[model samples]
Target: MFIGAVPKEVVGQVLATVPFDAWGNVYVGCSGSFRFDRAVKMRHPECRVYSNDVSLLTCSIGALAMGREFPVKFKGALAFVEPAIDGLDFRGRVAAVMVAAAMGNFTGKNEYAQVHFRHYREHFRTFVDQALPKLDALVAEIKIEEFYAGDFLEQADRAENSGGGMACFAPTYKGGYERIYKLVNENVEWPAPKYGIWNPDSLPALIVSLEERHIPYCVISDQLLADRTPTTEWRGSNKPVYTYSSNQAASLRRRLPNEVPFKYTPVEPAAITAESKVSMCVVDSKRMTYLKNVYLTKGIEHTTGQINCLVLIDGALAGGFIFAQTRFGDKTRELYMLSDFAIARERRLSKLIPMIATCREVIQPINRRLLIKVEYIVTTAFTTKPVSMKYRGIFELDKRTADHLQYQSAVRNQSIQDVFHEWLRKYAGQGGKPDRQGQAARAEAAGEECALHDAAGV
Candidate 1:
């Protein structure tokens, strides 16, 4: 059901500007429609084109489009693909790798009906069984050397290291929803929902990783914003194609070599003494949203009864936690769920205990006014820690939410209180000395006396 084809204009731009040399291999990752693969084959018949994908259905489609025989068995497709690529001779050839990554999960119309994991697994297995042999034979006959079936990042790394070639990534765009809807309106039957969209933020991380590894690459995306525009002239005429090449290809690489992956030094536990004042206060929604976007993976979803708390160290935003009303089956006696709880990566380990203590303290007063019982706190393992056997009373796994194991902790119980008090002692120790108000008062009095003396002298 995923949209397989990239726009022809985009493909043309890629074909026109991509720095592929004669006798070079074009390695395509997530080659959905094989549009780029076929184009490369026609343009440079002498050069080999290699494609990689994780999905068997997609691989089969790619094979069919390339006029290659489908693989008979799916089980050994992975076994054959990896070895074949590893065996290829990349010496003295211009290898251009294209990756059309499948990075999103789709919600099919039959998703609710397809309840069991085994059912989905078996359904996919059947297609793999049918497609593997044909795909294997297709790879053998065509100029394309291999069809890798695994993680795109891993394969990309391999292609960069072994082939030392130019890499192209055709990630999904923001306007993809509209395109998919249009396709559906035209009765162009695609899967119910396409999951993968190229997030602009993800590009910098990828660029940083490639740069760190010294891999020469280019991103062929319409969705990439103008900020990432290379200094060189864009070659494509039809589509507004933005290309970022390595320093070897263009000057953009030289301008900003270390643009992303923020630098930070890890804070030591001993650095935060007992007297260190850890201030917790309510933060604005805007600040909470900013932190969530930067730190949390999925970002924040505004919900009812949501409270955002910021943990400040020396008046600087060190960390934060978010609490929202729980949605666990009908028992709504003012229960809450904790989520988007995080500290700056640099201060994670050292600040964890303090962050938890701060969260507990901040939530206590908020609960008092609403007469909120806070019977139990339910949080997913994706966002919080796992429910270990040692803390049975404090937390337990709720299996009803099957997709992600939800961990629930009873907040009203003595066990959780004891745990929090113990952590508070272990992390935040005794209080620091009170403010110097007495000294300030005396100074003010002396100043008044000086003013009177000055008046009498006058």
Candidate 2:
């Protein structure tokens, strides 16, 4: 129920601070509305772009408004679930960091009235839970709070002086409810439409959860507290105070808003499957590395032959993207190499946690075998070696952390040297790669059979 808004001046500052160009694509994340079409005209009015909204009404309005306002074409639609960002290619990639999230309207009758009444202000807190205790037990539960109920909130929702229907948030329902508002606390973690009104905080939740890993963001805030609110509430005049300030009108540099500082890059859990041109040079190099290093000798007949392909998910795309390997079951078992993952350099581990959860979900069904368990092979950073993990696994790289064989710790070998030998010895124990050995042995065998060419006349 946070009712404050960043002023228009502040909004100008925030938008101006955003860095977008023709080179990189920008990603916009919002729950419902946006505030910068006119500003975009005032700012970089030349860029052609696509915009989308989850609310059908807002998307239509924005499309119409953008078409009329900017000579440049603006295209896109809104969606309840964040639309997948891949499948689009353009000259520039950018970040449309939105400030309005968790603001989708609600449906309960009495619940809808809280947006207006003082008694229910606390009820509008962003993160509402079904079982979670409410800050104010007296306020109704979400089922009661979400919709605009007429019975419980008769005082605030009574008919206007005209004696007709009141404005928005005032449900005519005797009990059932419907409408939307900006809320706090709940966000993309629980992305269904019921929590509360859309607000500034929800944007960060979306960025971190979905786009944070791959995209750079510039926030577009919808602040209600600025000097230009409709009047006091939603029913006021639709026009804002600064209809269209002069292009040179001083842009307001904003004070820091309440948002978590992003710090870590996100991880893409699975790989994407799409048709695109891949060069033979790159594909061969990848196959060479995996074949020589991973599947050479040993019991590779087990998995490499068993699971012929590999899939990669670059979570840094828009939230993230999936990359899949294919087309070459031609040889033994075919496999696709990989692409370095993309992620935001400033998000936290908490943001990436979901990626792992999602990756597991994507591969879980296929990764597991029916009779004898097919192990889940995960690629992790070298730093993660210290933590104890319980699962049958193999390291993508050799680090001292993974060890079950005790003989490697024996004397005549210093601890560090012994550990190295332990891993190297076990790894090399399988001998030369099949590809390498096959080439050399075949060469030698050919030479021996052709002694006449090697030595003398005949």
Candidate 3:
């Protein structure tokens, strides 16, 4: 019910459109500030109101402000009080359950530092002390069955099964402040009962689960409504809202099959060859367009130099590596940095080593007229330790800094060449021949190498 920053008129419009009946019950989860709860109660004076929150201090303040009896002990209870009236009649009994921005603030230790926790606790105390006394009339007008102190998802699960009504949830959207916090933090385990909006996948998973459970639901967001495609007509600011109903639940159960499809397709290993050809050539803008679509991370805007090399396996585009002039320091005088690189997900790691090694051949000739006589290729690995170690093995580890693991380009291309030679030896031992197709690819690779050497007068 915390209507932070939203105009009162917008709140009124949203409350007016909620699918509810007179004298029904309404439940508000994560009822911070309880402003929206008060507004809802005022709109439907006869309806019994129930609220649940994790903080006892906030709940106590809410009780005092509204002139309601505060619970003596709060032990993560799912529901504050039972519905004043309950029966098999699911439609008109329970009105609309509104969950407004009810995501947990406790992301983890890395992001939720000590200072943040201190500030939050101090702010809560100050706000409650100043605001609780002024809300007496707002609290007294509506009957609150109980204020449960616990996780929102647990309460929501209970509410969903306790007969059907319109359930509305406005969770913190993905890619918001919370997501940024999670991304910045390291060694953090998000505590659960994690609901939709906890992670990017959680919301979709929640919807799929609801569909499987026969809980009909639709996602609503201000962006979605502003685009003029709402699941249900509503009057309010285009704030994103997700609603599920018993009727939709029934339909979803009927439409979806019992089993869910497997989430991923198995990738077949790439064939190894004694004459497996990897040729690197400067890519045109058109090819760059195609690479951007397939590269795992980074787009053209992040890249800085013209020396973008396309890696072709035999004759198809298999991978790419882009180099940029160093913009960080005087290092530009001696380095051509590897800005972005990725192999197709379907490609094998055996192929990756050789493909990466090809950068050595590609870089040498390009440096002939380049601003800097490229002495070293540098890059940072920002992934987990194991993955960073893998990168370090391929590109010799230079140093471990606070922000990233830095790697120096190998002195010789021998690491990649050794891997390729080993694979070729195995292939030859297995009686594989250098066939016409393989020979043609090898010839093409040799020709490209000759062209680079010729251009560099090497």
Identify the leading candidate in terms of lDDT. Answer: 1
Predicted candidate 2, C-alpha RMSD: 25.0
Residue 84's lDDT within candidate 2 is 26
Tens-place lDDT digits, model 2, residues 152-177: 11211121111111111111122121
lDDT of each: 0.42, 0.24, 0.39
Q: Model 2, stretches more than 4 Å misplaced?
A: 1-6, 22-27, 31-34, 66-178, 181-213, 220-374, 377-458
Q: Write the per-residue lDDT of candidate 3 for residues 1-458, one digit (tens) a residue.
A: 23333346645555544444421666565565566556766776675666655433334445444444432311122121122222312111111011101112433466556455445334533433333334434456435566655444444444435432213343455435334333212221212122223333343333322322222233323333221123333445455433333232122222112112111111122444546654555654434433332232111122235565554445444445566666774554445445444332222332353335434565576666474556567665532132352353456676764324667663344433455454344322343222332232233221111111121232
Q: TM-score rank, highest first? A: 1, 3, 2
Q: Could you give candidate 1's per-residue lDDT for residues 1-458 as a string of tens digits?
A: 34636667666656665665532655665566556666777777776777765444445444443555332221121222222234322210001011111111222446553353224333433433344554454434445666654434544455544654435554556445344433122322222222233354555544433432334455555444433454233444554555555433222222232112222222233344434454555654544544433343112132323666655444434455566665655334434445434332222222242234223444466566445655556654321113322123334667432113455655443322343344456444544232232122223221111111110111
Model 3 residue pairs with clashes: 66-139, 214-249, 215-249, 216-248, 216-249, 220-241, 221-240, 222-238
Q: Rank the candidates by lDDT, best first.
A: 1, 3, 2
Cα displacement (Å) at residue 416, model 3:
7.6
TM-score (all chains, Cα) for each model: 0.38, 0.25, 0.37
**Regions of candidate 1 where Cα sits further than 4 Å from its true position:** 1-3, 6-53, 57-277, 293-305, 328-334, 347-360, 381-396, 400-403, 412-458
lDDT minimum window of 10 residues, candidate 3: 92-101
- How many angstroms is residue 41 displaced in model 3 relative to the true structure, after the best TM-score fit? 33
